[model samples]
Target chain A: MSARFVPVPTPETGTYWEKAAEGELWLPRCDSCGRAVFYPRSFCPHCHGDDLTWFRASGRGVVESFIINHNPAPGYEQDAPYVIALIMLEEGVRLTTNLLGVEQTPDAVRIGLPVEVVFEQRDGIALPQFRVITGDGASG
Target chain B: MNRAAGSSPVIIAGAAESPQLGTVPGQSAMMLAVSSARLALRQTGLAWADVDGLASTLPVVDLASYVGIRPGWLDGTVVGGCSSMLHVRHAVAAIRSGAASVVVVAHGESGRSRVGMPPRAVDPASMAGQFEQPYGMSGTFSRFTLPVLAYLHTYGLSPDDLAEVPVAQSEWAAGNPRAYRDKPLDIHAVLSSRMIAWPFRVLECCPLTDGGGALVLMSARRAADLDLEHRPVTVLGSGESCEGPGASFMEDLTSFAGFREASARAFRESGLTQADIDHLMIYDAYAHVPLYGLEDLGFVGRGEAVPFLRSGATRPGGSLPMNTNGGGLLYTHTGMYGMFAIQEAVRQLRGDAFAAVPGVRTSFVQGIGGMFGAAGSLVLSNT
Candidate 1:
């Protein structure tokens, strides 16, 4: 298979990729709104408060929605019929990620399935992905 | 002619689709835009020199130079496919506020041919590039269609419900000679067609075609002064709203917050309700959009759009005939399809639509941009 897209981190989001490399899921919390933000930004999208802090999360979420794309993106030709999903984190944030460790079928993948974050290393960067949680592994 | 006399009555004096639609590899994007602009301009009894305001998502400078317009007002509001809807809204405001008297809002896209089209750009460090695109989320098919499953799951609806949209619209498409997919469609054909993504078939998707449409907006007073042959289509109300960058960021996957907000504003400004609308045009880039549009625009209740569509309420001879020009699913979708939506609404109100609905005194037009990132709504009338 060809190499997938490697994300180039910006000044505001460098720590997200860096922390994922160290096997941790980190997110920014707005001090004013008491909310966690995804894909990292300078301030709270909710309140526009500049005072934000980053912390490690539980690295767990549930499949909120998904599509089994038969037509793949570039470098994903070999991985057609893959599951591209929206994972809603326990921290009350949602993200776009791939669901791993499961067969790419409707019966195998479903909404509300518990998933935990896993990283795929590409070009010295760790891109966060998810896999289905089985056997009492649901995170609180 | 002046039912909206209390407020400044902004009117679409002229509207026209390009001489060529569906496929015209011969013309560049600018050429298509200019061609439609000229057609609309002729209807208004105005010359390119008479256009004082210009608006488009295309290269505005090139459009201006080619059309020989030195405009005092120019709006280059580009928000994906619904950019033209916003342009019409802005043009209305510009005309009402005396920013410019003669405004021409235009759109042209070589979505299929890719002739003279800009390269698709994605900043490697941007949010979507870093997150969504890396997950192998295919273009609009995968990205925009992501929320449909959630919408279905939340409502306990099936793929059958999603299939009903194109099936209903195809009836209208058959009557429209200008539509790209003129043949009638059925639910069985929709379900049996090639599955592009989960819960969406190839038949449910809009075709990639090249087309251009333009609308000329001026005050009713200005249009009457010129004594143009065309009846003025008054802009009763218009509203626009924006949500987060991508589909996942939407506040609710089952519903669109931007659509609700924009439609509410349009209704409020128009002082009209659902019952007063005789015609509706919701941008159906995909079949799922009209479902969301009906519910979000308050035409139907939550989880009721599927059944409403299946009931033959939006088809020809229905109470509220919708997408009379076949919409984007069967009509020509030139990437930014909002201009086409507005054009159909104007045609319906003027009783000149290819598939005309009788006595369409008031028409409502709604558009969606990006992956549900933005929405624009307009209320128009011939009274």
Candidate 2:
């Protein structure tokens, strides 16, 4: 069976979800501070500058860190065990997503694993995920 | 350098914990917090009227205000596990600045007993909720598993090495009247327990405890006036640092840079080295935290904490008597074990611990806030 379904989004963050629906990872870059910000916001957290603009990302990054979850969360009981990873975008922005297309084991995942973005549709929402690049020995 | 040569020093006048934790039913989070606060005041021979500034975790903000403390400069820092330690540091600052002569830092959580609080909906556009939570990183348990598994692989340490922590801590708890899990757990029993996550067993994880703890900090001048039963444990040094709210921002999971920096600042400000600490009260939300904390705090070299534990360096009368009150492993972990470490450190300095280490003139306490995201350290000396 598929996992429990829910599509929850708020006005402040609706722009982010809207962009993701088009297969685009739109992150806000502060016009004043020149820092790329994730998790959509109205103002730059760094300089509190209101001048912000959304930009598309390269969608390719290295797996800076990851966790092989043996236990599942309440809503994610169907997928008892999965791999959750923190991907460091080439733009210097970091985002967390599930590492798909790889075995969920300690031996399978390692630091500096090269991965590219893949979108998983859930409840009509395109959720960003990652998979190990083929031929990459980093994926054990 | 003598800002106030003979000014009142802020000290931990008293500390206390709720009676029934881990399995208590029908007790609201506020009730547990109030009980601990009252007990702390009683221990210090003071009353609610004596407190002017209140510093505490976010969960107990309304409760603290209801207990007759004016909320002029109250701090409800919600930094996950290190909530209480951060509150302690804020309390010291409040007392020193004369904002309020007497400050209380308290925390409590009723995680096991359902409080009927609504689950907060995730906003996908928000930085954390959008970027991290959707990918299945819901809580600290899931996030912490990465570094823990990696540490095991890097060190070639077996689950048995991890089991020793709960085993030894449970043995310490057997002697602690207030510890929730007082039964002596053998290594075999610990290893045999069901797994909560890979490399972490049910025994290895802390219980969803329902408890509260409180500490009172007063200016040095005010501390001298009170007819205290025990000498006050002075806060020699304190420091805090944050690594943002995401794991990706960190440079190395194996080495907790924030904790290392905080510890260094605390030790330097206190003019004490690792060798000077007679006892330690490092936070142990999970078995691996103490191992990593020791390494990050310069107590042990990198990848060497496992061997140090095997050598009995952390047990009572060993090289360093750590977490003598059973820690969160055997004690109660109300989601914020960092505050409990501070309480234990004060108890040790005041010579009131169940397994009090002799000549404990100095004590070191370290707390991890988020998944190694933030850290707060304190050095207490009976000078």
Candidate 3:
């Protein structure tokens, strides 16, 4: 079986994965349709256009949804009770990431709470995670 | 035009579940499939030679050769949990197109026995792994349970509020003799159960087991020709749809577009409204899935399912009785629970279900694949 902790990037998504290593959120944009494409795809899902470009993201979004995992997730056992969230970015894209700097309880983490990206770099890999912005930005 | 709204052309003439569900210690997955296939064939009183169409998540060649079937048409649409439901739709289309008759859709798994399944990563090197695994995430329970948080937060429901799902489903299971656990379930028991994932206790998840199920769908002519004691169940409407393979690609976490599209097309095809449905079965992979399934199918408005279920709407004696076979939660899951869903629907329509719903003239069955990657729904009526 393949290792679950490492990334398996293809030519299409190499740029996006490499940018994550540089502590930045970069995604592709279709030049033909002017629609943002996610998951580092080869073509625009909206227009099926092949002309795509990459750009850095604003790294700001709100929590659309999330779940707290109290069980072990292989390498993430120590991080039990972790918050996995679907963060909807301002650029109209949504991706899955962890919620940091917040209590693991449901009352602490909420939908529509404003969050910002935080990069975690180790073992030559950098991943973008989300943290609920404290103070005025925090809804709950 | 979809066939359901136009004409009802297919009839489910035969259906069977493995005689020994929960487990068959020595049997391989193939043995389970063949056993169920043989049982269904006997029910239809059709010989193996009469089977012209074959479908399953397993390779058709493996199951066919084992069962000695030389199918004229085959469908290998394995979309995780919804595979069998999708196969039924594919078979309906093929039967209508004059491609074949007497289509047998089967699903067999030894998830409990681990007889034929391959070993994979807690998280694999698929598209999901490439994007999310680098962060050290693993296992499906956590990844799949993430939607409940969204559901709770969106609807202002608490984790305890969601506890009603498994509790009520267990009540129905209590009446099912074949159910894995028929003991009464309560919100207190569910909330205090071991937390596999926060907000999702062990009871909220389906128990893995070993079993197989098969359904025989024949064209109207072939079905009419069948000389069987069991009443035929007509396929009044059927619909199947896929939303790719990635969970993060979902436009809405709390609701599924695939479920909505498939069920809408199914009801439209059936020419039946929500009030017309007498029974319902949705793949209960976890506690949150039913909530999503109910809302997406428009059985209830958004933010209505949790409260509706809490009000005993899906309880055994309640209006719109659901998952009467104890569902995947208390009943047998056997990896893909879709086949079991179909089997229960058939039994309920035949008025022979162990946890039978009274006078089930119309049943709507939905099967979900992956983590909302695909979904298929069917409207069945007693013939």
DockQ of each: 0.77, 0.35, 0.58
Model 3 has a DockQ score of 0.58
lDDT of 3 by residue, B173-195 (tens): 88566788788898888888888
Second chain alone, TM-score for each candidate: 0.97, 0.92, 0.95
TM-score, chain B, predicted structure 2: 0.92
Tell me, by DockQ, which candidate is best. Answer: 1
Comparing 1 and 2 on lDDT, the stronger one: 1
Question: For model 1, how does the per-residue alpha-carbon lDDT over B122-208 read when each residue is reduced to its tens digit?
Answer: 667878778777888666888888888889999999866788888888888895668998988998888999988776788888999
Segments of candidate 1 deviating more than 4 angstroms: A136-140, B1-7
Candidate 1 lDDT tens digits, A99-120 = 8988999889889999999998
Top candidate when judged by TM-score against the true structure = 1
Q: Fraction of the real A/B interface contacts present in each candidate?
A: 0.77, 0.40, 0.72
State the lDDT of candidate 3 residue by residue for A56-98, as single tens digits. Answer: 9888899887767775455666677788788889889988888
* Model 2 Cα lDDT, one tens digit per residue, B154-246: 777765688878876765678566787888888899899976665677788787677778888886677666887677889888888887665
Span of ten consecutive residues with least summed lDDT in model 3 chain B: B1-10
Isolated chain A: TM-score per model? 0.92, 0.85, 0.89
